[model samples]
Target: MRSIEDRSSGTSGDDGSSGDSIADAAKTVEEQPAFQAVARGGFLMGGLVHVLIGWMAVRLALGDSGGSADQNGAMAMIAQAPGGRLLLWVGGLVMAILALWFLLRTWFAARRGHEVKAAVVDALRWSGPAAVYAGLSGMVLRFAAGGGSSSSAQTQSATAGLMGSGPGRALVLLAGAVVIGIGIGFVVVGVTRRFLRQLERSGALSVGAALRITGIVGYIAKGLALAAVGALLGWAAISADPDRASGLDGALTTMAGLPAGVAMLLVIGVGLILFGIHSGLRSRYQEM
Candidate 1:
């Protein structure tokens, strides 16, 4: 009878272990999920922005060359080519569609009181403008260099170049440069300890220090990635390499054809998206 009891007890222990395993599996599935509907919209918007920018670049590449052209001129002059028009038409249509998608998502998310979702969606809002700014910046700056500000090339150079040719110019340019640097710095600092402190004061981040730390860590990781991107882009721009593509998508596409660049860009974008998702997830977890 003692031997029989021992066998039954061992069987119960094994069953308990199995039950625990199942519970753990279920928790993992629940905890590790894509952000609810809103995030999906943001992701799509970013991807579309990248694609449209790439399409613009590819179109420029296929355009007519005006001869004596190096890479920058080649790209700009390509705009004058026949293929550019088609690309512009199709690209414009697609960008509009994507923009509408973004607007609708933003509206619904806001209606649902998803502020963080709104912010994530707004970041994507920059994507289209960023692409346009990049393409035009390249075209105008490269094509006319010193004397084309009024000639349809309203790129960042004009804004970023006000420094130091004269006392007034120097101060203005310096200030502008400072602001631009700070803006980029926020991408990484957005997840910093100081930011958390500020948030705590404002009651924006209320999950206590532990969850805040994890969330900050995630932000810092994203910031780190964006930092690398910012560095590469900054270097290429500072060196005045007109041949280089404007954003990561453009840069990657130029460095390695569409497929590889798209894959790399996708990974980077997804990582950032997930980092944003972490905040919402943590809030949900806390409620539980």
Candidate 2:
């Protein structure tokens, strides 16, 4: 048999040098300013999306009823606008970049020699948003390819399918609960002003009072909207009525149907717009 050094050397080929190359490559990519810019652009695109969706929700609140008040609705509006397709293309590209950026961030964090549990949690945190960014990128690309607009009807249909079977129905209920939990987490983040930690300290401090106000209001509104969607989905699961399940569009509409519902929707709409503005600033000020 070979000596220990030979075995170790052989093992390096299988598990060491290539891994170092990947980590080095990740570090190089992370160091590039252009990559950072693309990530920022992706954040800006996300902000613009929120702004558009909020505007649509506001319109619906005012009784226009012209379109859905969600991401798909926002895509439709963008497609109709001058140079909308170009915007979608650019946004989609940047969002894809953002997803990669998130992965890089997770990798860097995991390499910090932190406790395994903490690193894993951090990885999961980054991964959730990475998945979201990836999904948004796909949606933008789909619209650019003339795949047509998004609709909450799709959500309802999926919910209906889930409710058709016992196992599926249980999964739907679990999903709704998870959504609610996410919404509550958002609320906690907002109320506790934890989001500011994501921004560069100097940049965040320089933005002043408006940023804080917007961040707080925006997060709360979004949290409430998500909670409403989750509640609706749970209700649908319980009632065996998939039609009762909806996304943001449905949630806001349901709010509109309640006492002072129109006013509530309008408020939520404004809150969403504020969130968009906050997101836009974050694109510039994020610590990366």
Candidate 3:
């Protein structure tokens, strides 16, 4: 019979071999044409959603329409267009593929050697983008399947439910704080042009001044929107009122109620449009 030490060594070798195989498989999939196509398509889908939301916001700013002014509103708009459902199906599948790709990429990245603290931070940061992509994919699929829900309504309902429990308010507050921090980070990334790090310098430099301009405006606008949403959530938690926590739609609407609100909305709307363009460009120029 084999000694216990011999069995342990054999098991270790098996584990090491399996890990190497997985790493190689991930690398091959990462370089595949099909994977690249889907990843780029996912970026386009994101851009399309942003464009729709921005257009809706522009209309709302001009008092031309009153839509949800969020991703849900974007879906509704898409559904009204010709062959929208088909596009939604395609977009959903692309997003799902992108999410899986991101997961694999993140896994490979985490396995690389680095300081423990740096690795942890990198993992957390990448996990956020992965989560966002996954959530968007799920949302797209739901819309494609004709089982959609208003983002604002969902957020409010969630807030309301949380407020019902003894520790619910605290939980809501914690969530609000986290979102606010993310918003601030977004702003920093924009102002510092840190987003360029994700793109190939050679490709990004070809865009010249426009890239810098759009990157700055887009990040700030998005950050502000996120901050507004977080503030609303925090307020709702404090007041014990879910109605005040109506998510992005409510936050944008609130902005419309302020002085020169229309002008502000128009500016923000333009910023979002620029951001959409930037996102689409990323599909072409991203480091992948």
Cα lDDT of model 3 by residue, 191-243, tens digit: 99988887776534558466778788988878877887899889889988899
Candidate scoring better on TM-score of 1 and 3: 3
Evaluated at residue 30, the lDDT of candidate 1 is 35
Question: Can you list the residue pairs that collide in candidate 3?
Answer: none
| Selected candidate, larger TM-score, 1 vs 2 | 2
lDDT of each residue in 181-252, candidate 1, tens digit only: 644555555545544432322244454554455455545544444344344445434444423313332343
Over 4 Å off, model 1: 1-184, 187-192, 200-214, 251-270, 278-288
Q: Write the per-residue lDDT of candidate 2 for residues 1-288, one digit (tens) a residue.
A: 443334435565657687668889888988799999999999889989999888988998888988889998888888899999999999999999998999888776665555666777778778877898999999999988989544568778778768888888788888889989998988888899888877776534558566688889899888888988899888888888888888888888888899988988888898899999998988877888
Better model by lDDT: candidate 1 vs candidate 2? 2
**Span of 10 residues, lowest total lDDT, candidate 3:** 1-10
Question: How good is model 2 by TM-score?
Answer: 0.92
Segments of candidate 2 deviating more than 4 angstroms: 1-14, 203-206
lDDT of 1: 0.40
Against the unseen true structure, what C-alpha lDDT does each candidate score? 0.40, 0.84, 0.82
Report the poorest 10 consecutive residues by lDDT, candidate 1. 146-155
TM-score of candidate 3 to 2 decimals: 0.92
